[model samples]
Target: MRVRPFAVALMTAALTPATLMSCKPSSPPADGAQPPAADAGPSSTQTDTAFAALSKRFLDEGLALNPVSATQIGEHRHDSEIDDLSEAGRNKAIAWNKAMLAELGKLDIQALSRENQVDALIMRNNLEGSLWDSETMQSWAWDPQVYSGLAGGAIYNLMAREFAPMPERLKSATARMEKLPALLAQARENLDPARVPKTHAETVAKQNKGVLSLIDTFITPNAGQLTGEDRKRMDAAIETTRKAVEEHQQWLDGTLVPNAKGEFRIGAERYDQKLKFSLNSSLSRAEIKQRAEAELKRVREEMYKVAQTVLKDKPGAPELPDAPTPDQQQKAIEAALELAYADKPGREEVVDFAKHTLDVATKFTHEKDLVTVPDDPVKIILMPEFQRGVSVAYCDSPGPLDKGLDTYYAISPIPEDWTDTQVYSFLREYNKRLIHVLTIHEAMPGHYLEGVHSSKFPSTLRAVLRSGVFAEGWAVYTERMMADAGYMDNDPLFRLMQLKFYARAVANAILDQGLHVDNWTKEQAMDLMVKQTFQQEREAEGKWVRAQLSSGQLATYFVGAQEHFDTRKAWEAKLGDKFDLKQYHDKVLSYGAPPVRFVRQLMLQEPIQ
Candidate 1:
C-alpha cells in the first residue's frame, strides 16, 4: 500500500514543532506586524530575515503546545508533555495558530526567497486548516481516531526510536503515561457519541487496547534498564496507564460504539473545502475526477495489452481483441493478473519477503543511478497493532529532527482469525511481483528516500510541514519511473503488476470522491475496485473500511502523482536536450518535498506565488 506520511498529523489539528527552546516571540503587532519605522518597505533581505525569525518562534511555541508530536519529531525538551485535548486547550492552540499566521502575512512574500515563500504558504495552510477543523468541521467532537492516535503516539513515539538514551526515553514515557488518564478523560468528555461514526468508534475500541501492547513491547522490556526510584516510577506509571486504558476501552465499547450515530461521509461541501487544504493543490474535485476517470480508462487499456502478451499461448487464456469490449477487457486482464498471483508468499514469509524486496529495490536503484540513493537505513517490520485496521503497509520515516534513526517500512501481518481463503486472497493481491512494486513505493527512492532528502533541506519550517502531495506523489511517480527504467530487467509480469498498482492509485482518486461526496454505495465501490481496478476481495474490503475511516486522503496518491508527472514534463520541456533524469530527480527532491507546483516553479525559476 502507498504510505500516508501525514495521515494522523494532517487529520489531527496540531502543527508539530521543531526542537527545544525556552524563549518565544511576543504576540503579533497590530496591522499584521508591519516593518520597523526605519524601513517603510522591507528589503528582500529584511523580509527573509523577518520570516525566518517568525518561523523559529512558531516552532518553539508549537512544541510546547503539542509535546506528543514534539517527541515524535525528535524534540526531546517537550518529551514529558502531552497536548491538552480539552476545549480550552484547543482554543489556546487555535489562538496561537492565528497569531503565527498573522505574523506570517506581514512578510512580503514577493521580496523573500522562493524557498521561504513556499514555507509561508505551508504555514498559512496549516494554521487555516487547524482553525477550520476546530471551528467548522469540529472533528474533535466526532472523531475518536484523532484522540486515539494522540494517545498511542504519545507512548509510541518516545519508544519507537532511540533519539535519546533508553533510560531517558523511559523517563519521558513514564511522564507521558502519568498524563494518559487525563487525555483519555478529555477524549471521553470531548467526544459526543451521537456525532461519532460507528466505524470510527468500533475501530478505536479495537485500537485503544493496542496502547497496552505498545507499553508492553516497547516499555516493559526496558524497565529493567532504569534503576531504583526511576524503575519504581516506571512500574507504577505502567500500571496506572494500563488501568486507564482498560477503563477507556470499556467506555469505547459500552458507550461510544453503542451510541455512534454519525455519518462517515463529510458530504460534498466539506469535502471540497478539506480537499483544498489537505491537497494544497489548484486541482478541483471536478478536475481530479475527470483526470482519474480518464487515467482509469487509459490504464485498463494498457493492462489489457499486457494481458495479451502474458496469456499469448496459454491453453485457457481469455480471448484478446484489438478493440475489446469492457467484459472482454476485464477477463483478459484478470487472466494475466492471475498468472502473477500464482507466485504467492506463505503467510509467515510476508515480512521476510518484504525485507528481501527492499534489498532488491535498493540495489536496482543504485545500479540504475536513478537518483542519489541515501545511505540512511530502512528496516522492514510488522505494523504495530494500534495502527492496524487502516492500510496494509506504510513507510514510517523518522522525524526530520531525529537524525541517523532508521526508517521503517511496516507491513501489516496476516490476521490470525482470517480463514485460509481470506489469507489466500491477501497473498494473491500482494504477490511476489507486486511486493517489489510495493517495496519501491514505500521504501527505495520512495517515501524513505524522499524523506532523507527532505530533511537535508536548510529550512526547519519546510521540514516540519513537508508536503504530503509531494511525498506521496513522488512515491507513486517512482513506481512508473522504475518500470520504465527496466527494473527487474523489464520483466513484463513486473510491469503488469506496476500498472495494476498504478491503477489502484487512479481508482483511489475516484473512490475517495465517490465515497465521501457522491454517496457511492458499497456495491458501486466494490465494482470499481474489484471489476474495474482488479483488486483482490481482501484488498477491496479493507479499502471500504479505510475509505469510511478517512476523507480527502485517498486522493493524494493520484493527485500528487499527476502533479509530479506534470512537473517532470515541464522540466523536460524547459531543459530540452539538457534534461537528465537523475539530475531532475535529485533537483526536485532537494526542495524539501513542497507542493509539486512549487517544486516546478522553483525548478523552472517561475514566479513564486
Candidate 2:
C-alpha cells in the first residue's frame, strides 16, 4: 500500500498438478482399503470468478488502508485521508497483509486463467513483500525519509493532479495538512536514533524542510478560491503545517544528525530478500552479480572501441593497439567523451533542451512506427524542490486510474549553491546527446508511452502492483532500441552515448551489491563510476549518496534490461519473419508493467511460472 514513487530509472517455485480420479468404494475383501475419492475442485470459470472477486476485494481493502496510495493511483475515494504511521497503524497494515495472503492461499492456482494466475502471483508477492518490509526490513524505524516522504506526499498528491476541482483538492490538502504535525510526531517516535543511518537522517532533514516549499509552491496558490471560513481554516492549516515541518527539520538537524549511528548496509541476507521481492525474477543474487560483472566488462570494451573511433584523429591520441593498456583505453575514452561534453546546454537552457529533444524523439517514434504514442499529453517541468537530491530527472506519470491528466517529465535544475566545477561536471554528463537519451528513456517511448499503455490495461491489481523491473527495464531498453533504429541519424556519437548510459546501468548493479553487500568504500564506488563507467565526479558523488540511501533498486536497470532483451531474443527466434516491433511492443505493454518473465509468459502463451 506504499505510494511508490514514479521516478525514472528506477522469485520462483515449481508446482505439480494432481490428477483427480473417481474411485468406487471397495469392499473390505478388496485387494486394499478403498482410497477416498479425489475432489476435482472448482471449474476454471468458477476459480476465475472467485479470483476476480478476491482481487477486487484486495484492491479495495488495500486502498482503504493506504489512502496515500489511493491518491497516488488516482483513486479519489480516500484522497482526503492521511496514513497512520503510529504503531497501531503499522500493526493494522501487517494484519491486513496476513489476511489477504491467507485469502490468496485458498485460491487454486491451476484452475485460474493464465492472466488470473499472474494476478494471483502479483497479489501474493505484493502482500508478502509488504509484510516483509514492515516486519523484517523495518524502514519506518531506521529511515527518516519514509516519514518525511509520506508527510510531503500527503499534500503533494492531492495538489499535483487535477482529479478534482482546485477548491476540492485544496480542501483535501488542508485536511491532510492539518494532520501533518501528528504525522511528524509519529515519525519522531517511530525512528530509533540508534538504528537511523546517517545519510537517511541527513537527507530527511533537508527533505523535511523542503516540504514547506511544496506547500508554498503547490498549495498556497490555490487557496484563494476558498470562501471565508474555508480560507481561514486553510490558512491556519498551512501555517500549522509550516511550523510543524520547521520543527521537524530542527529536530532532524539538532537531534537525529548528532545521534544517527546505524549502518547503511542492510547486509547480504536482507539484500537478497528485498531484491527477490523487488525484481520478482528467477535470477539469483550471485547470478545477477555475475551477469552484471560480465556486462560491465563488455560495455567498457565497447566504449573503448568507440573512443578509438572518436580520438583516431585527435592530437596526442593513443595508438590503436590490438590490446591497449588500461591507461591508454581510459585516456582515449575521456578524450572522446570530451567532444560530447563540449556541446552541453547552459544551465538556464537545460529544461528547454529536454523539451526540444522530447519533440524530436516523439516525431521519430511516430515516423518509424515504434510503439503507439499515447494521445495523453506529457509536460516537461522543473523538478519540485522536495523531490531533488534523489536523481536528476524522473517521469511522473499520472495515476493509471486517472484519465486525461498530464504526465510530468520533471528535470531537476542545478542547485544555486553548487560550485562551478560541480555544475560543469553535471552539465557535461548530461550533455546534448545524453539529454536526448534521457528524453527517450523518461518520455517518448519510455515511461510516458509505457505508462499510457499501462493505464489502459484492464486489471486494477496489475496496474497497482506495477513491476519496477519492467518499467525501468523498458525505459533502458528503449534507449538502445532508438539508437539501433537510426535515431539521431544513427550517429555513432549518439550510439556511443547510449552505450555509456548502458554502462552506467551495468555499474548501478555493481555499485548496489558492492556498497551494501561487500562494504565498499565511497572511493571504490566512485572509481567504478568515474573510471570504469566514465561518469562525472559530481555524478559519482551523487550516486554514492544514492547508493547508500537505497539498495536492491539500482540493480533493476541492468537486471531488467537483460530480461527484456532475453525475452525479445526468444520472441524473435520463435516468430522469425512474423516478428514485428510494433506488435511485440504493444503486446508486451498491454499486460501492464508486470515483470518481464510474466510478460514473456503472457506474450508466448506459455505456462505461467
Which candidate has the highest lDDT of all? 1
lDDT of 2 by residue, 158-196 (tens): 887777889999888888889889989998898898999
TM-score of every prediction relative to native:
0.91, 0.90
lDDT of 1 by residue, 330-378 (tens): 8999889889999988878877888888888899899999999875567
- After superposition on all C-alphas, the RMSD of every candidate to the true structure, in Å, is 5.1, 9.5
Candidate 1 residues lying further than 4 Å off, grouped into runs, are: 1-42, 347-352, 375-394, 409-419
Q: Which stretches of model 2 miss by more than 4 angstroms? A: 1-42, 375-377, 380-393, 411-422
lDDT of 2: 0.76
Alpha-carbon deviation at 69 in model 2, angstroms: 1.8
- Candidate 1 lDDT at 596 equals 79
TM-score of 1: 0.91
